[model samples]
Target: MTASLSWQKSTYSQEQGDCVELAVIGGAVLLRESDNPAVVLRTSRANLADFLQVIRQGPAKNSPPGR
Candidate 1:
């Protein structure tokens, strides 16, 4: 199934291993680690966008006393 999809690595990735690759198929987005190509994660574009947004925002302000 992954053979047909075009996987893309992040520009920030400098090494051959330990990098994340992404591919879009139909209405879903696919992701996998270069070192572990056999394991893949599928999610919608909207959900991926939300996850990226949260990552960009850094840690949340409201957390337990001892984080």
Candidate 2:
């Protein structure tokens, strides 16, 4: 049987529509939004890490702190 994913919202999200969740199950990372849990995005943890790294090094750096 497939194991259920334990999804958690992003710390940066508020109680409204701007909610994102992530989980690691086996060899893949799962992503979803609180506004719609019926759909999911899956990818490798390495890929996710790389994407985050790029975001960190990109224009997101211009975002206000404490985000």
Query: Whole-model Cα lDDT per candidate?
Result: 0.92, 0.81
Q: Which lDDT tens digits does candidate 1 get at residues 1-67?
A: 9988999998889875589999999999999998899999999999999999988997779876665
lDDT of 2 at 3: 31
Q: Highest lDDT among the candidates is held by which one?
A: 1
Write one digit per residue (lDDT tens) for candidate 2, span 1-67. 1237778889898777568899888899888878778788999999999999987886665778765
Stretches of candidate 2 exceeding 4 Å from the true structure: 1-3, 59-67
RMSD of each: 2.0, 5.9
Q: How close to the true structure is residue 18 of candidate 2, measured as C-alpha lDDT?
A: 62
* Candidate 1 similarity to native, TM-score: 0.87
